[model samples]
Target chain A: MGAVIYDRVALIGLGLIAGSMGLRMRADGLAGEVVGHARTARTREVALQRGLVDRVCDTAAEAVEGADLVVLCVPVGAMDAVAREIAPHLASGATVSDVGSVKRDVITAVGPHLPDGVHFVPAHPIAGTEHSGPESGFPELFEGRWCLLTPLSDGPEVERLARLWNALGSHVDVMEPDHHDLVLAVTSHAPHLIAYTMVGVADDLRRVTDSEVIKYSAAGFRDFTRIAASDPVMWRDVFLNNKDATLEILGRFTEELFALQRAIRTGDGKMLEDYFTRTRAIRRGILDAGQDVDVPDFGRAVLRKGTAG
Target chain B: MGAVIYDRVALIGLGLIAGSMGLRMRADGLAGEVVGHARTARTREVALQRGLVDRVCDTAAEAVEGADLVVLCVPVGAMDAVAREIAPHLASGATVSDVGSVKRDVITAVGPHLPDGVHFVPAHPIAGTEHSGPESGFPELFEGRWCLLTPLSDGPEVERLARLWNALGSHVDVMEPDHHDLVLAVTSHAPHLIAYTMVGVADDLRRVTDSEVIKYSAAGFRDFTRIAASDPVMWRDVFLNNKDATLEILGRFTEELFALQRAIRTGDGKMLEDYFTRTRAIRRGILDAGQDVDVPDFGRAVLRKGTAG
Candidate 1:
């Protein structure tokens, strides 16, 4: 624990990311006091019971009343309304940030509603699990992950926010919001959309049957299933907000897929081999870059149990 | 370790699956005096050095001289030549099986060449890692994984092969060759094609550099990279041999992907959320079936290491 970066930090929307932030902030004494607000009273109660927050407020307005830092950790679609409701209650000169995946859209939706003298630095911590809700969070979620801070301008507030994330155990990177979206499209959004599509296709396969697909899924389709199992509403909002970049990446993916399909239909083994070899290099690069350190066989640890059955 | 199922078992290739089979069979004493052969002397030497086989032969014919069971573990494209080379030298009443991802193609390639009194039972083990070669294999590779046997006949020979696989630590399922191909198309082939296409698209992106894609890949693309990193020659053979089924499943995937893309374009959150929710259920079904046991946050274990940078 270090010196408190913010005397009081308010987190709106007590879900996985928000709850994770609360736990991480408290663990490191990044905030003197942590408060939280959720749309439903049940979630607020869960957050309080889980010790994700020191105080649980009934409304976002009340949560931000005396807090030096307020983070909008809700879905992208709900950010505008929350910003409108809490703008009047924000403390003077307080730094306000958001944990939305889409940055340009978030800035567009929430920037105008903020009161004067408040900072609107949008950030995205590229870390999560398939699990959601306040109970799904742990203090170690952000360790060794990259957190992107998309600020319109560089100043003391942005530096402080970066330092706070550093304390939370993330390697912080400052990027333009558009670049962040395009990079995310290439790395996260498009892949997730494709995984969802693949799982949907397998589910809708009449010939193979869903039961067989599920039973034999350990081969390869299981990876797609894991990615597709993420929170539905959060992903829906992500696609709706980051439409342009996601669509563009999807277009490129479609083109590449069609070329491979053609190669397969034509019996062009060399073409397929060349393409596979090239893509294989990217996986090596990811491992070399330390972005992915998972074992080649992910389920080995689980399978190593005494009972093979 | 248990009683030997075969006096001498011949593995006709020295790759991950075959090497793992040798290690596992030796570990459990499933086969007496396991021998192996590969087209390249380098692979033979590696297999011998790694103890993947007791005797590494220079020729497939030499490897199967006195063996009661011969497993063709070469790439799908190479199965025909291997079957031709080893057919004349096989012991009478010996059982022959191949671990090719596509069954119908293997049957077509190797069925006519097998001599009378010899049994041909095609099997496809639903297990592998991105790493290849003899050194990559381990005794536990087949534990808790499925090995699909697509035999043309239901007889004692098929049951023996099933028992052999069971002894090696895999759940065996019997299906018709054509049905196995289609099921694998939905579960393995098409998903692998999509993953390769996604990685290729990211590699070819003009705006997003490869470094950026690799760095931010911990989000979702990392999973695709792992799938796409599989053996290039093996995957090429898979796409080429399983063309019709893979292409059909890919067509369905494209349809589903376009529907989601349109939903994103029109801001149809309901449709997107509904589709994601449905796919999420399939993931749950897969987990419930015990096909996948790892928590969704695969990166956490690696991230927990002391080096945050």
Candidate 2:
């Protein structure tokens, strides 16, 4: 494997992904200089203190100066503003990619802001932790994880950018941005939404179930609580950016859910058993495929059922 | 705490719960002798080999001999046969209790078999793990957990037995049999069914998404997988026995899910965020209440999340 990818790489937004990028780039000798940008002075200070970046710039435009590669690692809602700010200063022939969860919105938000000479690439690494901030990231977050690239054409710049992620210890996959959104909606967004809903239901169960909630959570509901504990702001933007695809999957999910509810009401054990049995196999598939990144909590937000002071 | 709640303890069904009962009884010195009975020859052998019981009996009748406490830890479907098998040999004044997840059916199945002098207490310890076998038990399984006792006021031995679980590291709450079912339906059964359905949906996804299902499962779906990966036969029995309560909760769950699904379909970010925020508080409640046991797998399955291999 190539020990290094970029001589001078810029990481904008010193949150989980950005910090993780800097850590991995440095740990694997993947970059010589990792310059980072953050709007908040405290976060920038903390990012530097945590050794997440080699250089902390005052602005995104300043961070991208003289950079060969720039990875946009910000919330989807902020993509547009950041893109416009950095576009004017991006070096010619530089490759700009992102690490946003929602792809289509990033493309729409950042595409027009790219300068004529700057090469644009959008990527979503299928990796993260529930904990957010520079302090929470580690060097191995991207190791053996999938970093998806949604390139626009057969440009050598795009392929080279894809190869860069591969060098950073990621399995690179290229797909259409819309398809990426659809797939994620089905696999990720919808599940998180349902988890949020389940946690809400448990919360609304009044005081009686309240006392029993945590004690007996081992029965099943604790899983939802873990997922629902995820960062609220990041998720809010994700839902906002990927509304249509999420809605489509949510519709299908509700339809299936209602049918199962009907089966339960009607005492259809066969149906219930069939559904439960089928799901068990899927869990096996995940275990067999080795997709879970050896993390017991699976990067879930499990503050209570997970970990917290 | 009373070290010996009963002079002798008989455990029917040598699975996780039965083994756990023996381990706990021995660890806490809660029993004079622990006798385990299982119909399967191999289970009996395993129980003996693992020291799950002071003595492994060939029959329920032999197991219940000289016992003041008899805990039915068998599946709900097998309750009656075991109850009847032991009824003929149950010592006079002995208190009979159960650790089944569902109470109503257990009352129906084991109630008729109870001798006039034997007390029948239906108890549900709101805790469990995915693993099921003689060796898949631990002494601390019931520590600080909630155990619901469906009391028959007419029975003295049952009330005495209910007090035993309270002393055995469980916070005991007594309620009518039917009422207990309703509470559990919301707290445990419905959540489990939903988890099962979601996992099934993921399993039924296209080959492409299926391949990435476990890979990106850490994002959310892996939690569902963990819950869905519970013992199939035990879960099957829970739904089958607790049909009324499970169905009622299922109705409410679907109604709530529908409202959320509609909001998602219409691109209502406020509704999603509102629900998500509301749920985060419940997890806090569970923690503040001291219910989030810091054991393996949220106190259900062994949680080896990021645990060193």
Candidate 3:
């Protein structure tokens, strides 16, 4: 086993991210003790029953007491309230971080409530599945994934937090909070909102029944449904928090979509083909960077017996 | 082996769908002979080399000369030209079908060019990968997928075509041409165009570099890239041919997106949450129908060794 990076690590929200972190840390002996707290008693019980933490606390303040590292894994809208609850109980020299998707809003929501001696380092792990809650996490969720840390100060505390994440099988990169928010807006928030919008549109269509959409989803709509099934409360908070950047990207997307729609109306195949070809190059770049597997259909066909070629 | 459904099957345009059909037919001995043709010599050579066809003909007319079953697997835009080329060479009492995504336009474009003795049964297999070309096909590609056949007449010819698709491991359903186009516009055509548009917008963002997007794609944009990377020519033809339905759905999508955008701007979390919750139910319905696998992230983590939980 590896060396323990922190003596006591407190997870403020026992959801997918925190549960995964606890599992990884415990499996690798990366922390001396992993304690967790959730807003609901049922979640706390599940976190304990599932071995996601050594002990479950009923209150956020009780969870953070005497901990050297504290990570907030709540939805973005709840971050401020959790921070306010846990601020008085945090130990001196404790490094506080978060796994929120938006960095700037998280920093704004969480930074003010911390104590003077605590080091506040905001982080966002760029890894997840559509499943949520404490039971949906696995130890390898962050393996080979990128964990972005937007630090307020570059100190030993920040380095220590980065080392902990690295030991959990994630590659850590530090970015400015504003730049990180904007980047995630382009890459994650906008795409998720677009998927949700498209799926909602399909569901709302009177001409096409839900049964027909579900039966023939393999055509292309299946991908959007997978993305749209992500945690609704979390996504709602993400959009509310990262409003500016998401709005900006969506504006550009609508403009580009309108141009393609016009091309279709005018039967301008060349323009549509050219635009599609350029976007294809971006997919090539993503595959080459090892961000996604190169398997066709994300290897879904191979998962079923007798379907692999 | 299964009994031969057709004495000879001719595939005009040796691409993913046609090549897959040839492989399945050959593997199951469902067709006595499978001959293919492509507009380019390279594709014809590859089709023969990959054993996707027993014989490779240079021209569409030569391929369909004595075949009892002729399947046009070309882009929607090229169906008219291919139909015109093979209309005079079609054997008497032969059945002509297609695997085009847009049914109404394919019916309109190829219906007039067929000989009076020929039977035109337009079929669409609601299955594909982002990959294309003859080399990218497999025998199991159509297994457990849906194939919709829109026939001009309910005759023995249509039943024969349906049986052929069933033998190839697909469930066949017959629908009207106009309804098929509108259903596909909601399920396939509009989602594809939206994915392409979002990927294009990300590619055009000046503030975010390509490398950043690629490195951080696991958050959500990876799914969009996979959908956007589909064959440009095929998608171009799909949009051009199904313009009315596609445009109508896109208009509805834009209106919904604007409403969500307004909610985000006004911090109406309840509206956003309600909409997201409703869309999540559709995903649940799709999962229950067995149309998509229920594993997290489409079982992508399982595909990589040492990453599965």
lDDT tens string, model 1, B1-309? 677888899999999999999998888888889999998889999998988999988899999997999999999999999999999999999999999999999999999999999999999988888888878888777777799998887899999999998988889999988888888999899999999999899888734464788877756788899999999999999999999999999998898889999999988999999999999998888777776665437534543362333
- Model 2 chain B worst lDDT window (10 residues): B295-304
Weakest 10 consecutive residues of candidate 1 chain B by summed lDDT:
B300-309
Candidate 1 residue B173 Cα shift, in angstroms, is 0.9
Q: How much is the lDDT of residue B102 in candidate 1?
A: 94
Model 2 local distance difference test score: 0.77
From the highest TM-score down, the ranking of the candidates is 3, 1, 2
Ranking by DockQ: 3, 1, 2
Question: On residues B1-309, what C-alpha lDDT tens digit does candidate 2 reach at each position?
Answer: 356877899999998888877887777777888998998999999988888888988888998998988999988878888888889898888888898888888998999989898778788887676667787777667667788888777566655666667766788777788867777776678878877777766666656564766655645776677678777777878888887778777776777877877775676778877877787776676666666533222322222334422
Best by TM-score: 3
- Best model per lDDT: 3
The TM-scores of chain A alone, one per candidate, are: 0.96, 0.92, 0.97
Q: List the residue pairs that clash in candidate 2.
A: A296-B305, A296-B306, B297-B303
Q: Scored by Cα lDDT, where does model 1 land?
A: 0.88
Model 3 has a DockQ score of 0.72
